[model samples]
Structure formats: C-alpha cells, structure tokens
Target: MKLSGIFSDGMVLQRNAQVILRGQCSVGGQTVQVVFREVITCTDADPSGNWEVQLEELAPGGPDELVITAGEEKLVLRDVLVGDVWVLAGQSNMELPVRRTLDRLAEEVRGLDLPMIRQFVVPQSYDFHGPRENLDSGAWVPATPEGLLGFSAAGFFFAKKIYERYGVPIGLIQTAVGGTPIEAWISEPTLRRIGGYEATLEQCKDDAYVQSTKQRDEDRNGQWYARLNEADTGLREGWHQAEGEAAGWSEFEVPGSWAGSELESLRGAVWFRKEIDVPVKMTVGEVQLALGTIVDADDTYVNGVLVGNTGYMYPPRRYTVPQGVLKPGKNTLAVRVITTHNTGSFVRDMPYKLKAGGQELDLRGPWKYRVGAVTEALEPQTFFHYMPAGNFNGMIAPLRRFPIAGVLWYQGESNTGQPAGYADRFQAMIQDWRETWGIGEFPVIAVQLANFGPEGEQYTDWAELREEQRKGLAVPRSALATAIDLGEYNDLHPQDKKTLGERLALSARRLAYGETELVASGPMFARMERQGDALRLHFTEVGGGLTTRDGNALQGFSVYGPDGTFVPAQAFIDGDTVVVRQEQLNPPVHVRYAWSNNPAKANLYNREGLAALPFTTEA
Candidate 1:
C-alpha cells in the first residue's frame, strides 16, 4: 500500500480544527480506520484506492500519537504537537536569510532554540491546473540552528516570538517563491473569476504555450552563457600573452552602470580585468575581495584562480578570496559579467576593495574591458516557471488534512508595484485558501508594508497597495501588523527582522491567543478633524501618547490646502492627537505622513517607541 506524499512521521497537525486523514490503499480494500485519542473513524476507499477521513476536533494541548490502521498494516505518526499553524508567504525580502545580515547570525541562532516551533517549506513549483491533492514532498522540522538556515528568515523570527510567548507547538507552513508575481500564487479559478487574467491563465494552461515559453527561455540562457564563455576565453588569452592593447579602452567609474557611461547602452557579457599590487605580507593569508555588486551574474578570478561567483544581482558585494591566490605583486583580478537584460556594470554604492589580514587593498582604479558579443534581440530567461496548481496543489493541499489554529502571512512586496489589481487578487487568495481548508473563521494575521526608499518622493503606488492590505483586515477573523517605521531606505531586506517578527507575534497574541492587554499595533490613523487652520489627526492604539521617533520637531508630515498643493507643515504632539498646520494655508484639506518612495528620517512614533503606521488623510 502506498501513502500520499504529505503523510510522514513527526508531522504536526493543526490542533483545534477538523483533521482530514487520507492515503492510498491496495485494490479491493474497503475500509481504513484512523485512531486519535482512542476514537476510531472508519471510511471506505474509493474505486481508485483513495481514502479520506475527517476527524472531529481535538483539544489544544497534546502529546498524542495518530494511528491509521488498514487491514493488516498500521502506520503510527509520532511526537505530534498541536497549537497554532500559520502560512508565511512573501517575496525575496521575506525569503532573505539571517546569515545575510551582518554579524547577527551567531547570536540570533543561539537565541532561537524553540523546540515547539516547527517549519515546513513548500518546494518551489508552478502548475496551471486546479489545486492538487498532495505535495511533491515536504516535512516539518524543529526550529534549530541546522533547521533554521534554509527557513524563511522573517518567518522563523516571527514563529520564534509566538512560541516564546504562547508556550504551544507552532507550525509554520511556508509557501513563498522569490521573484514570483502575485498572479502566479492565486488559484486559477480565482484568476478566472477575476476576469482580466483569463488569457494569462489560458496561456499558462496550454502545453504549447508552456513549450514555447520554455524554448524562448532556453535560447536566451544558452546565448548568454555562450557570451560569458567567450569573454572568459578572451580574458585568459590576453592575460597569458602580456598584451597591452589598452589604447582604445574607455575610462569609466568603478561602481556605476555602464549604460549611461562610455559603454553606451550595451548588454550581454563584458570582461573587466584590473591589475593591483599585493604587498608581501598580503600574499600569505586569505583575502577579502569586495566587488560591490555587479548586474546579473559575475565570476571573479584572482591571479587566474576562480575565487568567487554570484548568480544574481541582489546579493551583497562581499566575496572571500582564498589564501595563496594572491601573489606578492602585480596580482590580476578578472571579472566576467553576464547580463540577460539591461546594461551591465557594478551598481553604485557598493564597496570595491581587497583586504588581506588587516590591510586594505584599493581596487577602484581604471580597468581594461572588452565586449565579447552584441545582439539586437535577446531571448528571455525563465528562472521561475508558473505551473497550474503548483503551490496550492503541491504545498497547501497536502496539508489540508492537518488541523491548524490559524494562518499568518507576511507577503505583498511582489504585488506592491501592481497597485491597480492587487487588492482584489490578495483578498481572493485569502478567501480561496480559507474555503479550501474548510475551517471556521481561522485567525489570519498579515504584516503591513514597512517604510522604504528615499525622502520626499511621493510618486509611489506602494502607498495605495498598503491601503489595500489594510482593507484586507476587514475579512472575517483577520488582523494586520503595522511596520511603517521598521524599514531601511537603501536595503529592501531589513536586518531588523527581530522587531518585525515580535510585532507579528504580538498581533497573534491579541487576536488569536486571547490576550487583551497587549498593544499589538502602533498608532493607526482613525479620524481627522479640521480645527480652524490646523488639521487635528486622531489615532488609535496610542499606547502611551503621540511622540516622534527622533525626539525632535515632527517630520514627514505634509498638508495640502483646498488648492491641492502640498507643502511641508509644522506638526506638534498635543496629548493623544497630532496637530498639523502650515502658515500659508488658512484651511488644510488633506494630510500625508511618510508619503514617499523612501521616507528617510520620518520620525512619527507611538508612545511605546513604535513607529506610527504610515497613512494619509486624503482618499
């Protein structure tokens, strides 16, 4: 008898909901009995040898074993604990690892020894069909140093906070794919119901369409790799022969895009080689080479020894060069960069230096470069492929049988740029998942988008998308965690995940764990009243009172008079309310706080040292 893919030993079931047990049986087998806490439920197998049983709700606390008996065979699931279950879904920032954050990995890992916290990651997949009945493969593992490495960094931290406070076994089911669009995660039926995505889903379903897309991606990938090989060969040949054909080389900055520079908007593979002198003391030990960041992909070699390589552009610029690779003098550093789309070069603000032991080796001088190939048209590479029911079928459907308390989500970055349609799409996804699970008003908590980007640039659709996320809380039994002040401008993946996770747990504590005194959110804009020339803004969850994070004059507050012209306004804290007034305007109609691509130095905060949620009084 073969079991369904999702069934395995040591799996954590959702504690207080209807638990569905299912599997495959041999031919002619009529019945299967599922026993939990001495209760036996019998169900007959279908003609296809598939069987399912929906068990009654179990108590919250458990150290029980589930036994499924069929004829002469018995399968016992061990060490099952049930408390709360959550689904952590998001893009790259949520997927960013703790190890990437500078110097906090060891301490974070040592502190994250929660035995009751477990995580199950859905393998990346895409399907055009309806939801599948089972997952390809996945299992729940305890949250330890070894288990947490590949886990979603934000999700792990969020679960850790919940487990510490709740004292119950927490199950985290992660189903996020990096760089995936929101449409890809939505169910096909929901997309069709939404109407505009019919053609897109139809294209996804057709085998011919998939084949053509795959072919185009393959062709593009092959051409790019070929160009990279050619550049590497050319650099190797030129370096070996001591060639000095540097007359035609153009001068360019070390860490800026070549599109606006001398390279003149060329894409594909380009080879850059620079010669730097390594002191005698530097040659004996391992060296640190900071190439900053290169567009697309880059392979670096020190003295012809391949030292480091990066597959994508978003990772940091630091790379370790092995010891003995650097000679005493005239060490050669060759970098082969391949770009699938757009111009190629080292991105600005990235560090470019080579440090050996304690000495810094400057690598910011002019270098020689040559273009290997140029093509008018390039094929598109599909690193991520969308399939029918890929995630819903493989990841979520398999766990439908397990009873869970609720779901927590930290997604929407990928969907933020598409402001026009994300609200309905996100709401549809939540509804679909809830209906499919057949659970009754299971608690769902979501993390609101944090503040990001530069100051004073308010031409962002992200603000609208955030409003959409807030509106999602209107769904039954749903809550939102506001994180407006926890984000950094230059870095999309913030290292302050600890605070973000704790805040998320606080929301769960208040909404799901029956905690009443917890202030889970910062000040949220409740109402705005016009008082003469000033707009008096009222807020909720003002734990202590209204304050500024910077302890200075209120910044990030802007007011627009009836003329619709916005200007910087003087804002002051008046007890629980904030007053905003600009001298030029006799009447202010609208007010916006931290409204920009990046709200740098914006310091609105609650009395609890938490940043006030970003919002606007305008529609």
Candidate 2:
C-alpha cells in the first residue's frame, strides 16, 4: 500500500474537518484499514488498485501516530499533528524563496524557530490529459533552522505570524511557478464555462497535438540555449587578458547603449575590453566587480578568466573575483554582451566599479569595443507551461482532498496585457477552487498587482489589472491585500516579502479567522458624489478615520471632466472620506486615486497604516 506523500510523517491534518485518506495498492482486491486515535475507517481496493477511507472530523491538537493495514502489508506514519492548512498559489512573487530574502530576513530565519510550520512545494509540471492523481514529488518539511531557506518567504512569514499568534501547527501547500498567468491555474471545465478559450481547449484536448507541441518547445528551447552557449566568446577565447587581441578594436564609451556608437541598430554579440592596473595592496580583503546592468544578456571576464554571467537582463551584475584571481599588475576586464534583438549596452545610473580593501576602482570610461556575428531576432519560445488548466491538472488536482484553512494568492501581472476578461475569469477560478476542494465558501486573500515600471505613466494595463483583481471581491468571502507602496519600480519580484506576508496574514485574521476588530484590508473607494464644483469620495475600511502613511498631504488624486482630460487635484480629509477639487472642472465626471503603473508618492492611507486601493470613480 502506498499513500500520498502528504499523509507522511511530520504532516499536519486540517482541524475540525473530515479527513479523507486515499492511495493506491496491489491490483488484487483487498481491504485497507486506517486507524487514528479512537477512530477507525476501512475501504477495499478496486481491481484497478484505487482505495480511500473517509475518516471522521478531527479537532485541533495532536502529536499522535497513524497506522494503516492493507492485506499483509502495513504502513505507519509518525509525528502527525492537527492544525490549520493554507494553499499558497501564484507566480514569481509567490514562488520567491526564503533565501532570496535572506539579506533582509537572515536574522529572522536564524532566530525564529517554530517546528509547527511545515510546507510541501509541488514540483513544476503540466498536463492536458486530465487531472493528475499524484504529485511529481514532494515531502513535508518542518521549519528547522536550516530548512527555512527552502520555504517560500511569503508563505513562511505568513505561517510564522499566524503560528506565533494562535499557536497552531501551520501546513502550507506551495503550488506556484514563476512567469505563469492566472489562466494556467484554472481548470478546463471552468474555462469552458466562462468561454473565449474554445480554440485553445480544442487544441488542448488532442493528446497527440499537445505532446508534439510540448516536445517541439523543449527541443527548440534546448537548441536556443545550446547555440547561445556555443556563441559565448568568453567561453572560447580568453579575451579578458591584456595579451589578447584588441589592437584592431575601436574605442567606445562604456555606460551607454551601442546605438550611440558607430555600430548603431545592431543585434547579437558586442565584445568590450578594458585594461587596468591593480595594486596588490588593494586586492587584499573582500573584492567585488560590479558591472552595473546589461541589456539582454552578458558574460564578463577578468584577467583572461570568466568572472560571472547573467542569463538575462534586469539583475544587476555583481560578481566575486575570488581571492587570487587578481594579481599586482595590468589586468584586463572583458565583457561579451549578447542581444537577441535591439541595441546591447550597459545601463546608466548603476554601479560600475571594482571594490577591494575598502577602495573603489571606477570602471566607467572609454573601452575598446568590436561587433561579433549579428542575427535577426529569435522567435519567442512557446510557453506550454502557461497553457490553460495544465498547471492545475498537474499541480493542484492531487491535493484537492486535503482540507485547508484558506488560500493566499499573489498573481495577475501576466494577465495585465488582457484585462478585459480577467475579472470574470478570476471569479470563476475562485469558485472552481472552492468547489473542487469540497470546502464550502473558503476565504481567498488575493494580493493586488503591485506598482511597477514607469511611474506616473498616463496609460498602462497595470491599473486595469488591479481593478480586475479588486472585482474578484464580488464573489463571496474574497479579499484584496494592497501593495501599491511596496513595489520596486524595476523589479517584478519585490524583495519586501515580509510586508506582503504580514498583509496577507491580516486578511486571514479577518476573512478566515473571523476577527472583526482586526483591520484586515486597505480602504476601498466605496462611492463618489458631486458636491458643487468638487467631488467627495467615500471609502470603506477606514479604521480610526483616514490618514496619510507619510503624514503628508494627500497625493495621487486626479479629477477629470466630461472631455476625458485629467488634471492633478488637491485633496483633503473629510471624516473617513476624501474631497477632491480642480479649478477647471466645475462638475467633475470622474476621480482617480493612485491609478498608474507606479504611484511612487501616493500617500493616502488609513490610521491603521494600510494604503488605499487604487481606483477610478466612473462618471
């Protein structure tokens, strides 16, 4: 007899809920007996080897053992407990591990030791054949001092806060992947009920077609990576040394795009070489070579040796040069930048230096640059992982029978491009999850899309996507955890996961745990009314009246007339409300607050310190 990994030792079963134990056994028919404490349940394995036993509801608190017997075979599970379980689901933000936030959370991870917190991260997989009955592989892990690094930071801190407050063993099922859209998590039936995916579903239903497409994608991606690897000049030629070829190269500035150089509007690799002298006195202690940020991709080298390589753009390049890599003499710093399309160059306003022994060596100046092979832009790889319902079938279907306290979701960035049907799809997904889990009306706390990209941009899909996330509240027992003030302007994976987790825990306290007094959510724009030449906006969840987080005057409020033109407006607090006005509009048709990709300075907040949800009051 073999049960699901979720039923193993050190696992936490849901409290005050019916426990359904399921598994597979020998093909020959045999009765399986499950005994826990005073409760006992039994079921017979079918000819196909499926078996399950519905156990009675259990209360909180347990450090007991579970014994199962099937024919002559028996399995025993130890160190089991009864507590609250929550499903952690979403994209990169939700999948950001604890180690990524270690710089900020290292002390917390080292000190906060609670063995009651556990997690089982589902291995990434996708399937269109149907729901998978078993996960690829996963095992329950306690929050040991060394194991905390493996847990999702958001889920870890969330469970930690809850466990600290309520003293309950917290079990988290991490079902998330990076760069995935919301549609990937919804079931096929749910997507069909909502429509618009008829063609996608048709293609999905074909087993041969699905398998062929997936295989083609894998082969194509493998070839692409292999080609790039071969084309990496830093790996083939030791051009980072002063002895390498550079006499024929031309001098070009280092801190700007190649577009500014003679090689304008070119793609592919551009090799840069800079020779510098380093003293032994400066290379003694901790040393680092900062290459700022590169466009597309880059592979940097020092003194004929490869120092570091960044797979893609966006991450700042900070590579360690090792202890004895730098000698007391002239050294070469070479960088091979690869751009599939558009100009490849170094980004400005970032650190470009070599630091050692508390001394800095500026690396921003003229350097010899030469263009390598140029090629047309590569076609985007097919994302079979983002196909509708495939992720749900492989990642979530196996855990449907496991009872949970609630769900913590952080996604919607990928769906920002097409926000038209997001609201309906989001609501349907929530309903589908609740129905499939066999839990009636479970609470779902969703983290709204955070501010990113250019601040104060007049037009963008981010705000619209946030609106769709908010609309999900139309479904019963759904809440939004606003993060307008916590986003990095350039980073989609915000490192401030502690705040995200805490905010989610607040929602759980109110929506899931029924804590009425807790200030669970930020203020939402309830309604707007015309007050002569001004507009008065009412807000919900204004605990202790409205106040700014920075204690400054209101920011990010705009008034628009019927002409559809908007202008910045002055706002004032009016007893749990905000009144806005502009000199031009005698009767404003709409009022928008914090409605942009990055409302950098938006300061409206409740006295409880939660920021207001971004909204636009319609005409």
Candidate 3:
C-alpha cells in the first residue's frame, strides 16, 4: 500500500480531535486497518483506490509507533506524537526562512532543539486544471538549526512559543508563496462567490491564453536582454566611472521616481551622477554614502570606484566608499540603476547623505541622469501561482483530512490593490476553507498591514486594506495582529518577526486554547462618541488600559468637519477613552488615526506594547 508522505514517521497527530490518515491502493474495496494508541480503526478503499481512516482523539504525549495494513501490505511509522497543529499561510513575509533573519534571530535560533515542534513545508506549486487531492511528496522534520533554516521564521518562532507554553508537540504546516495575492490562495468555488474575482478566475481556466501569454513573455524577455547585452551604452561609454560617464548626461531630480520626471516609459540601465564638493578636512578618511533608495536595482560607484550594489526597490541605498576613493576638491558619484521593468528611479523621504570625519554632505535635489541603454519593455511575468485557486489546488487541498488547531495568516500585502471590497472576498475565503475542512468556526488570526510607502497626504489604498482586515472581526473566532508600529520605512520584509510571532501566539492562546484572560491584542477602535466639540473614541481589547508605546502625548489623530477636510487634531488620554479635538474644526463628521502609507512616527499603542491599528471613521 502506498500512503501519503504526511502519514510517515515523525509526524504529529492533532490532539483532542479526530485525526484522519489517508493513502491509496491499486485495488478497490481493500480493507485498510490503522492502529494507534487507545484507538484502532478500519475502512474500505473507494472505487478509485482512495482510502482514509479517522482515529479518536488521543492525549498530548507520544514517541509511539503507528501500524497500518492494507491487504497484507504492512507499514510502520515511528516516533509519532499527538498535539496541536497549526497552518501558517501567507506571502513572502510568511515564507521568509529562519536563515534570512539569522542576523537578528541568531541567539534565538541557537536555543532550538525541540523535537516536539515539527514542521511540514508544502512545496510551492500551482495548478489550473483542478484542485489537487494529493501532494507529490513532503516529510515532517524536527526543530533543529538545520531543519528550522528551511522553515518559516515567523512560523518557527510562533511554534516555539506554543510548544514551550503547552509542553505538547506542535505541528506547523507552512504553505505560502511570496509576492502572491489572496485570490491565488482561495479555491475557484470561493472566488466565484466573491464576484470581482470572477474575471480573474475565468482567465485562469483559459488554457490557450495562459500558455500563449507565457510563451510570449518568455520570447520577449529573451530578445530584450539579448539585444541590450550587445549594445549596452553604459559599458561602452564608461558609465560605472567604476566600469567608467558619457558626455552631456541629462539632469533629473534626485530622490524621486525617474519615470514621471526624467524618463517616461523607460526600462534597462540608466546612469546617475552627482558632483559633491568634499571638504579637505573630511577627505582624510573613508566615508559612508547614503543614496536614500533606488527602484528595481542599482550598482553604485564613488569616484569611479565600485562601492556597493543593491538589488530590488524595498531596501535603503547605503554604500561605503574606500578612503582613497574620495578627494578634497570634487568627488563624483555614479549609480547605474537597472530596472528590469518600467518606472525606475530613486525614492524620496529617505536618508541621502555622505558622512566622513564628523562631517556630512546632503546628497539631494539635482542629479544628472543619462540613459545607459533603453531595453525593450519586458513583458509582465505570468504568475500562474498568483492565479485564482492555483495555490489551493497544489498546496492546501491535500491537508483537508489533517485536523488543525487553527490558522495563523500573515497576508494582505498582496491584496492591498483592491482594498475597497476585500472584506467580502476575504470572509468568503474563510468560509470556504472552513467548509472544506468540515470544521465549525476554527479560530483565525490575521496580521494587519504594517506602515509602508513614501510620504503622502492620503493613504487610501493601505488604509482601506487595514479596515478590511479589521472588518474580518465580523467573522466568528477571529483576531488580528496589528503591526502598525513594526514596519520599516524602506524594507517591506521587516526583521522584527519575533514580535509578530509572539503577537500571533497571544491571539491563538485566547482563541484556540480558551486562555481568554490573556490580553492578546492592542487597542482597536470600537466606536466614537461625540462630546461637545470633540469626539471621544472608545476602544476594545485594551489590556491594562491604553498608553502610548513612547511615553508622550497622543498622536496620529485627525478630524474632519462638515467640509470633509481632514486636519491634524490634538488628542489626549482620558481614562480608557481618547478625546480628540482641533481648534479650527467643530462638529467633526469623521476621525482617523495613523491613516497614512508610512506614518513613520505614529506612536499610538496600548500599554501592552502593541501598536494600535490604522483606522478611519469615514465610511
């Protein structure tokens, strides 16, 4: 008898719930016998050669052996345990491996030796034909330095907390893909119920369109890169200054996107240069140059010397120049920004300075921009994995039989594009999964979107997205991990995953295990009461009452009057409620807090050290 890999040795069965063991046989109507501690079960294989047997709940300790027999084909599984199982699902933030965060969590990772905490990572795959029933292959692994390195950082830390607290085997099933939207995770049927995704779902089903598009993109990318390589002006004209500058370089605004200002619909390598007058005193030693941020990718140079290279747009641009690379009179900084796609440039509202010998130079305002080579537009990548129902078919469908405690989801960054009506779609997805699992109201803890993006007056996209996540509270047994205070201005993959994991466990403690007294979340804006000229905002889940993370005045509050214009408002704490008011506005129609893309310093948190989520009273 061939069995599913999850039913192999070293796997953990869910405690206090029926555990379903499954596999297949070549012959139909075969008798499948499963033997476990305090339980023995038998079942007949279906006509299609599929068989599954459910065992009664077992206690939380094990190093036990499990035996199964199907028509004289005997199999034995060793070192099995009974305990809580949780599925951690999301995008890159959820797929970030422990090794990626080793710089920060090294000390934490070294302490891991818990064999009780096992993990099973669903191999990343996508399917459009139909929802798949069985995974190709995967094996359960113990929590070790080598093993944990492949596991999700957030999931590992969360499992460590749960295993330590409960002293039970914890099974973490990590099924996530980076840069994927929520629609990709939901099943086709679920997407059908959610309307707006119908078009996307239908397109996913079109085999001709999918294959043709893929081929076209592949051919186009091959041509563009091949052509650019042959006629790279950046190399021919001595652009790197490190590689070497061309004459008459065009001028463009520094710390801004080049697509809108300097180059429109531009792709490929573009060289940037700025002349800085270094003082004689500061030139005695090496200096660190901060270029703020660059889009797509970049190779930076100082006085024609290679300093550093940064790939991608999310990280800040900081390169170190050698001591000899700088001179007293005039210093040249050349950066070759390589954006594979369209819309490339240096981002604004970031640190752009050169520091040396206790002296600093601001590298902002004007910089000469020149085209290295304008490559043909690269076709958008066909993300079959991000297509509707694709991930669920390949990753989630096989886990329908394994019972789980609950789900800890750290997604929604992919869904921010359609924040206005995501609540219904997300809720529909929750219901569909619950229905598929045949479990009633299993708890779900979703992390709210963290602060991000450049400085802007209005943050309609992400703010509305946070509101949708909050609106998920309308569902039963759901909690949210508000990460408003945890995001870095330049980095999308923030390194403070420990707090996020701990926070997720806090909610799981209350929802999944009935530890109801635990203050698992930050203050949530429950309702507002208009008192005189001010609005008194009441909150929910404020453990030990509300207080700012940094002990100071309340900030991030804004009020809009009858004219529907939002203005910064003065806010202060009063008992458990926060009273907000602005001198210029009266009879406030709406109030919002931390309602921007990157509310860099929006320090509104509860005494529990959890950041209060962004919210708006409007609609």
Q: TM-score each candidate.
A: 0.88, 0.90, 0.82
Flag regions of model 2 displaced more than 4 Å: 37-40, 61-64, 107-112, 218-236, 241-265, 272-294, 302-308, 314-333, 342-369
Candidate number with greatest TM-score: 2
- Report the C-alpha lDDT of model 2 over 1-619, residue by residue, as the tens digit: 7777677888889998988888887755888888898678888898877888876778777788889888888888888888999999988888888876654566777766678898988788888878888764677888887778888899998998899899888999899987789989999989888777778867877988877976887787677656765765644665656575687888988788777666666656778999888888767877789887788788788877788999677666878897887878788888888786656768765678998987888999998887655655655666777889989998888889888889999989888888877888888898888888987999999999888876767765998888888877899988899888888775666667888889999999998787978888789989988889989999998988899988889999998898999889999999988999998776788988888889888899888888899988862
Q: What TM-score does prediction 1 earn?
A: 0.88
lDDT of 2 at 326: 82
Give the per-residue Cα lDDT of candidate 2 at 526.
92
lDDT of 2: 0.83
In model 3, what is the error at residue 541, expressed in angstroms? 1.6
**Model 2: which ten-residue window has the lowest total lDDT?**
232-241
| Cα RMSD (angstroms) for every candidate in the order listed | 3.5, 3.1, 5.8
Candidate lDDT scores, in order, read 0.72, 0.83, 0.82
Compute the lDDT for candidate 3.
0.82
- The best candidate by lDDT is 2
